[model samples]
Target: MGTLIFNLNMMKMMKYRLLFLYILGMTVAACNNDLPDELFVKRVVIAENGFQDLRLEYPEDGTVNTQITISISGTSVLSKDVEAQVKVCPDTLDDYNYERFVQDTMLYYTLLPEDCYTLENEGKVTIKKGDEYALLSVQFDLSRLDMFKDYVLPLEVSSVSDYEVGEPKYRKALFHLNILNNFSYVYTPSGAKVYNSGDNDDYTAWTTDLTLSTLNYNTCRMYAGGVYETDTDRDKYVIQVTVNSDSTLSYTAMTPEINLMAEGDASQNRISISESPDLLVQNKSVITTTLKMNYSYTYTSPEGYPYHRRFEGTFTNDRTVFRDKDGNIREEW
Candidate 1:
C-alpha cells in the first residue's frame, strides 16, 4: 500500500522533497479531470479484492456481527443518493483461486455455507447524498463454522443505479474468515523436572518457560527431554503435542535422535479449562489454559554420552480479553 517514488529531485533536499510531493499531488488532481468532457462517468469500486481477511474473536454466544463498506469514485460528490446491487459471485472466487494456486488445490478457500451466515441488508446499498460510501451489515453463527476450514464469502457490486460498476477485476471481493490462533506461545512450566535419569543429577529450571512453536493448526512443538535446548541440537529434543477433540492429548517425536515415550499416568495427559459462570455475559473475561503431560526422551550428547530425561509437568497460559462500551471485542491479547 505504500510506495516511494525515488526521484533525484525529491531526494536533493527536504525543501525539494516537500515541493516534489506538492507537484505530484497537483499532477494527480489534473489527471482526474482528463476524462473526456463528452463521456463523463462515475465508478463504483471495491478495492482490488482477492481475499480480505476479517478477524473474529470466536465470540462465546455463537453470534457475530460485522459490516463491509462500498465506495464510489468520482471527482465530484453526488447531489442525490445512489443505489447499488450486491450479490454473491462464485465465479470471482474461482478466478482468485485459479490465479493464486493453479494446482495447489489444498490451499484454496471454500465458499462459506448459507447456514453459517445471514446477509442482514439483503444486497442493496444506498450511498446517501454528499457521501462517498455505504455500509452493508452481516451476522454469523460461529457454531456452524469449522475452525479449520478456510472459508470466504464472495461478494460483488453487480449493478449500480447510476454509476458504472467499476473495473471488471476490481468490482468483486472475498471476505476471508480469520480466527484467532490458539495454544501456541510462552506458557509457565512448573512441577516439571529435567535431569540425567542415568546419573540422577537434577537439571530442573534450566529453562523457565514452556515455549511452543506451531507444528500444525491443532498441535504445538516444544523442547523435550533436555529442556535446556541449544541451537545446534534443538531439533533432536523436539516433541509435538496435540489436544484432541475428546480432551485427550496426542504426542509425537519429531526426530528419531530423541528416544521419546510417554510416562506416569498416561490417561491424565489432557487439557482442562477454567470456565467462569459470567463468561461472555460480563462483556469481558479471562481465559486460562493448562496443559498437563507426562513424557520422557533420551538425548545422546556430543561426547557419545546418553542423557535419559523425563519432562513431567503442566504449562499454563492465561490472559484477559476485554470488550468495549460499544459491544466490540478488543481481543488481540
Candidate 2:
C-alpha cells in the first residue's frame, strides 16, 4: 500500500511540474511577440547610459570634442519631432555611487568638475519628424582635469518634450574619461631592460614592462629600473622624466636618496627617443617609439646596503595615429 501511495505522489508531482512548464512556456512566448504594443512602446533614452570609457589623447587645441546620442526606442520611428534636455546631474551621483560601492565612500566615483568640460549643445537635443535620433555635443579641456583622480561625467536626459523619457536605468550616462600624456599610458605598453652593478660586482640584469604615470603634458614618473612598485622606499628611487620637443629626455630623482646619478656616458643624464619608420607588420603599418636610456644612480637598499646601479636598454612602444582635417589628432606613440 505504501509503495502504491508513493507512485501516486510521484505521478501527481509530475503533473504539476508539466503544468508549471506549460505556463512558463506561454509566458515566454507572450514576451517574445504576443505582448501588447503598449508594453514595448517607444521611449526616449540617452543611448549611452550606464558607462562609457573615453581615452583622451593629447588634443591639438587642448580640447577634445565628444558627443552623446539620444534616441527613441521602438519597432518604428515616431511621426512627430521630439526634443530632449540633457543635464549634468551631479546630484544623482551620490545615489549612483551608493548603488555601485554600497557604503564604501572612499572607492566611490567622483563627478567631473564643470570647468573641465563644456556642454556645447547646452543640454538640448531634437529628433526631427521622421527621425529617431539626435546628438548633443561636448568638449573636454585637458588642462582642467587632474591626472591622478578618477572622474565620471554624470549626465541624464532630464526632460523630454514629446515622448516619455526612458526608464530610470536608461536615462543617464556615466562617462569615465582617461586622459593621456606624451610619455605615459594607463597600460604597460613599453618595455624596459636594466643592467646594474653593485659593491664593485660585475653586473646584474633584469627586464620589465615600464609603467610610466604622467605628471604633466610632457613629463612622467616611473620607478627606478621599473621594479618594486610597492616598495616603502620607492620615493627615493622614483624618477621624474621630461620628454623634450627635440626627442631628448631629462630625469630627476624624487628624493635625495638616489644621491649620485649620471648619463650612460657619465654626463648629466639626458637621453634621446628614437622612432622607426612606419613599417608594415601583420598587414598593419605602425610607427615604433624607442627610448634608449643609459644611466647610473646610487641608492641604499631596504637592507641598508648602498649600491650603484646602471641601466642600459630600450623601452619601445608603437601606435597608429588617427587624425581628422579639423585639427583633431591623437599621436600617442
Candidate 3:
C-alpha cells in the first residue's frame, strides 16, 4: 500500500509540472508578440526636387528619352538579404472609381493596362545583403504619349521578403505626368520697319522686341514693346496667340487701338490694327509675318480733317535661344 501511494503522488506531481511549463511558455509567447518589428523601410529618396508631381516639360532637344532615379532605404543596416517586387502599373481610376474609392472604406484599387509609357527595367527591383538601400532607374518616353492628355505611372512595391514595407503612402510612388505644350517664347525682332500713310510718322508699328507669355498650355499673350507695360506712351501692344491641335501657330491682336500721342491733339488720331484669318504659320523658332494695318485719324483742326491711311509690311522674328551661364544651349522656347 505504501509503494502504490508513492507512485501515484509522483505521477500527479509530474503532470502538474508539465501543465505549469505549458502555461509559462504561452505567457512568454504573448509577451513577445507585443514587441514591434525591427525591419522596415526608412525612407524613399527621389533624385530630383519637386518630383512628387513630376511634370515633364517638352524637351527642347526634341528627344523623348528622359530618366529619373529612385532609392529605397532601410531603417538599419540590413543583416540578411531582402528582395522586393516592383511594378509600373497604370492608374485605372476613373471619375466614378475614384469617387467610390474615396466614399467606401473597404474598396481596393484595380489596375488597368498601361498604354502611355515604356519602362526600361521591366519593373523588377532587388536589394542584397549588407546594402542599406536599393536603387531603381526609370526612363520615360514622352514622345509616345499625347501632349494634351494627363497620365499616371504608379511605382509600387508589391511585396517584400525580409522586411516590412514602409508607410502606406511611401510604399507606392505615384508620378503624375502632365505634358505641357506651351509654345510661348521671347524673341528678337529684326527687319521690322514702320510705314506711315496719314502724316503720322511718329507712331512706329514695328516691334523691336516681343515676348509671348503662356496664359495656358495652349494659349499665350504676345506682347510687344515691354512686359506688363500698358501705357500708351510706351506704345505697347498685346496679342493672343494659340497653338492649335495641328501644331499651327495663330495670333490675333488683343488691343486694337494704338494711341500715337498721349497729350497732344494727335492722341485723337489712333492706328487701328486688324489681322484676318488668324495668321497661320508652321515654324515657331523663326517666323516672318506680313500684316496689314489701317491708320484712321481725325485731327482737331478748323477743317475737321479726317485721314485714312493703309500700311503693309513684312516683319521677321526669331525665338531667343535659352542658354546656361556656361553658354550651353538649354532650350529654344
Candidate 4:
C-alpha cells in the first residue's frame, strides 16, 4: 500500500505542473494582443504656397501651387482599423507691450477654418492585419505677398479615435523674408573739437600736463586711454583717449617758452622757468596751453575695428604772461 500511494502522489504533481504552463502561455498571448501595431508616416507633401523660399522666387504678386505627402509602414497596427486627422494651428503668438513678460509668438501661416486638413479623395482606407505599408496626403493653399514678407507655419498629426490616444505633437516649418522700408534718417554726424591753445609755438611753451573735460555728443559719452598733449612736449604727457560708439572728437592746446640762466654756476647756463612765479599777468603777458583727444565708434551690424583719429592744435596769449620779480628773466623755462 505504501508503494502504491507514493507513485500516485508523484503522478498528481506532474499533472499540476503541466496545467500551470498552459495557463502562462495563454496569458502571454493576451498581453501581446493588447499592444497596437506600430504605425508610420512614410511621406509628407508640402503645397506650392506652403513654403516661401526667399532664395527662390515664386509668383511675387500672384500665388503658387503647394502640397504635402506622407508615407508610413509598420507590422503590428496593419490588422487594426486606423484613421488619422491632421490639425494645423498657426501657433498663436503674443505681441504685447508689458515690460516684465515679453512673448514672441510668430504665427504666420494661412489655413482653412475648422483647423483640420483632411487628405483629399481618400478619406478612410483599410489595411490587412499583416499589411506592411500605407500612405497619407495633406493639401493646402498659400498666399504670396505683393512685395515680400516673413511667415512661419506649423504642421501637426494625430490618431483620430473619439477615444484618447496619448498626446498630440507637431513640427515647425520656418519661413523668412524682407520687404521695403521707407523711413529716413533725420540727423547726421560731424567733427567737433575742444582746445586750450590756438597756436603751435604757445602749445610747446605751455605746461606738458593738460586735463580733459567730459565730452558729449547727442547725449552720449566717450572714453579714452592714451595721453594727449601738445606735440612739442609729447614726451611729458602720455594721454590715451577712447571715445564711445557713434561719436567723434578733436582737441587743441597752447604753451609758452621761457628764458632762464643759472645764477650760482654761470657756465651751467641754467635756462628754465620758475616752477611758481610771484606774479601772473592777466593782460600783455605770456601763457601757453595744449590739447589732446581720442575717438571710438560702432555700427548696426558686425563691423571691423573702430576708426582711430588723432590731431593737435597749440596757441599762446602774449597779453597775459607769468614772470619772476628779478630783472633777470627766467631762462630754459
Candidate 5:
C-alpha cells in the first residue's frame, strides 16, 4: 500500500510540470502577433546634408520672387494613405530658448515676419497608398523684406493621420534667409601701373594690393597699397565709400597716395571725387576715376635734406575677377 501511494504522488507532479510549459509557449506566440509593423513620416529632405537653410537674393534693379519645395519622406511604403499637417509656428529652439538650454552657443538668428512669405499647400500634404514622399511648396516675396536684415522661417509638423511621427530632431525644419543691398560686391584690384617721371625714367610698374577694412550693404572701407619697389618704397592709403540717395557713390580718402611723387613734406592729404560708375551695367567691369590729391610726405636724402612733392593722376581699377587665394571662385553674397 505504501509503494502504490508514492507512485500516485510522482505521477501527479509530472503532469503539473507539462501543463505549465504548454501555457508559457502559447502566451509567447500571442505577444509576437501584437508587435507593430506600420509606416511613419521619417524626415524632411533638404538639399545639403539635412540642413534646411535657404538663401534668396533680392536684386537691386528687378523684382525677385522665389519659390521653394519642401519634401517629406516616409520610413516605408504606405499600405494606406497618410496625411501630415505643416504650419508656420514659433521656433521651439529660438534665440531665447536656445540660450537657456544650450551650453555652448555661438550664433543667434531672428525670426522672419509672417507677412513676407506665403504657403500654397492648403496647410496639409498627403502620401497616398504605395507612395513614400509628400511635398509642400512655399513662396517668398523678396521685394517686401528689408535688404539689410537677416530672417529665419520655422516650420513644424503639427499632426498626422494614420501614421506616427518620426525622431524628435526631424520633426521641424528651419529656413534661414539673408537679404543683401545693391552695392554688396567686393571690389578687388589686380595691380596698379604707376605713371611717374622720377624713379623709372617716365613710368614705373607697380602691383596694387587691397584689404577690406569695413564692409556693409551701405558702405565699404578699404585700405589700398601700391608697391613702387620690392620693399624699399610703397604707398599706403585708406578710403571709405558710401552709397548716396540717388544710387551714386561718394568717397572720403584723407591719405590718398599718388604713386608718381617720390617724397613730400606736408601734413594734410585731400581727396576729390570726379565721377561715379554705374554698378548695374552688365558689360562694364572696369571703373576709371580721375581723382585730384594734394599729398605731402617727408623723406631724408643722402645730403640730410628733406624733399617734398605734389601730383595728380587718373586711377583705373578693373573689378578684380573675384577669386580666393587658392585660385577658386568665391561664393556670391
Candidate 6:
C-alpha cells in the first residue's frame, strides 16, 4: 500500500509541473508580442498609380490615425527599434521619349517626418512600444502628367527590428497611371466630284473636273475647271484660280471663320469665290476653251479621299481680260 501511494504522488507532481511550464510559456509569448514576426504592415492602400501609403496595425486592426506606426518590444525577437525608408523611380525608361513628345513630366515624393517622427530619403524609420508609435507621411504631386501609357512607379522600404540593429532589411511597393490619348481633328476631305460623275478613279490626263492626282500615300493633287468647294458641304468654294506652275496651282477657298492655333496653315486654304470684279465676269462668249492644268494634294486625316473644291470660270479666248458669264470683266480686274 505504501509503495502504491508513493507512485501516485509522483505522477500527480509530474502533471502539475507540466501544466505550470505551459502557462509560463504563454505569458512570455504575450509579453513579446511586438517581435519581428508579429510586426508588419496591415494595410497598403494605393491612392493613385504613383503613390502607395502604408498602414501599420498593432494587436490587429489598431488604427494608427494618419500615421504609419510600428511596434517594438524590449524583451523578445524585435527587441530593438526599427529603421525604415522608401525609394521610387519610373517604370518604363524606354518610353521616356514618348512622354517628352506629349509634354509629360515626372515627379517624386518628398517625405517628411510627421509629429516629430524622423524620415530620411533612404526611408529609414524608428518606432517603440508604450509610446504612440512613430509616424511617417509622404507627399507627392503628379498633376504635370499630360498623358500616360503603360507606366509604373516602384517603391521600397527598409527596416530593422529592435534586437537586430545591424541587419537592415527592405520591402517593396508600387503605383501606376494609365493616361489615355489626346488628339484633335482640324479639317479633312470627304471626296471629289465633277460634271461627269463617273468612277473617275483612273485618269492619265484630267481637265474641267480638276481630278486630284495621288501624290503619295497621304497626299493628292487636282485642278478643278468648273465651280466646286474644297469641302463637300459646298459652304465654301474656290473664289479665284490662278495657274501656279505647270503641275501646281495656287487658289483661295472661302470657308467659315477659322479658329486654330496657327493662322494661315494649310487648313486655311479653303475653296471660295472672291467677290472681286476680276474673278466675277458676266455675258462671256463661248469659244473653244482649253484648261491646261496639273495638281497634287495630301491627306492630313486617316482616310486618303481628296477633299473637293469647286472651280468656276467661263471659257475664254482672251487670256488678258477674262469675262464672267455676265460678259463683264472678271472681278478684281
Best by TM-score: 2
**TM-score winner between candidates 3 and 4:** 3
Compose the digit string of candidate 4's lDDT tens values, residues 290-309. 11222221111125333222
True lDDT of residue 272, candidate 1:
73
- Identify the superior model by TM-score, candidate 2 or candidate 6: 2
Q: Between 1 and 3, whose lDDT is larger?
A: 1
How would you encode candidate 3's per-residue C-alpha lDDT over 28-73 as one tens digit per residue? 9998898565555454433342214655555544334455554456
What TM-score do all the candidates reach, one by one? 0.52, 0.69, 0.38, 0.25, 0.42, 0.26
Give the winner by lDDT: 1
Candidate 3 lDDT trough over 10 residues, lowest sum? 269-278
TM-score, prediction 6: 0.26
**Rank list by TM-score:** 2, 1, 5, 3, 6, 4
Candidate 4's C-alpha lDDT? Answer: 0.30
**lDDT scores of the candidates, listed in order:** 0.74, 0.71, 0.48, 0.30, 0.49, 0.34
Q: Higher TM-score: candidate 4 or 5?
A: 5
Q: In candidate 6, what are the lDDT values of residues 1-333, reduced to their tens digit?
A: 999999999999999999999999999998777456545432222122223433211111111223333333332343434454444433332243345444444343222213312224345555543342355553322222221123344544433433332222213334333211100001122232222222345322213334332222222233233334355633322222333223223443333221111113232332321222333434433222232222222212226444432212222122234566666655211
The clash numbers for all candidates, in the given order, read 0, 0, 0, 72, 1, 61
Model 2 regions more than 4 Å off: 1-39, 91-108, 186-203, 232-238, 253-262, 265-283, 296-300, 303-308, 318-333
Better of 1 and 3 by TM-score: 1
Better of 1 and 4 by lDDT: 1
Per-residue accuracy of model 1 over 31-81 as CA lDDT, tens digit each = 977955434467887654556898764544667788878788877767789
Q: In model 1, which range of ten residues has the least summed lDDT?
A: 1-10
Scored against the true structure, residue 16 in model 4 reaches a CA lDDT of 96
Whose TM-score is higher: candidate 3's or candidate 5's? Answer: 5
Model 4 superposed RMSD (Cα): 27.9
**What would the per-residue lDDT of candidate 5 be over residues 135-221, giving only the tens digit for each residue?**
666767665655334567777667777545544456666676744443333333333333332443444343343333223445545
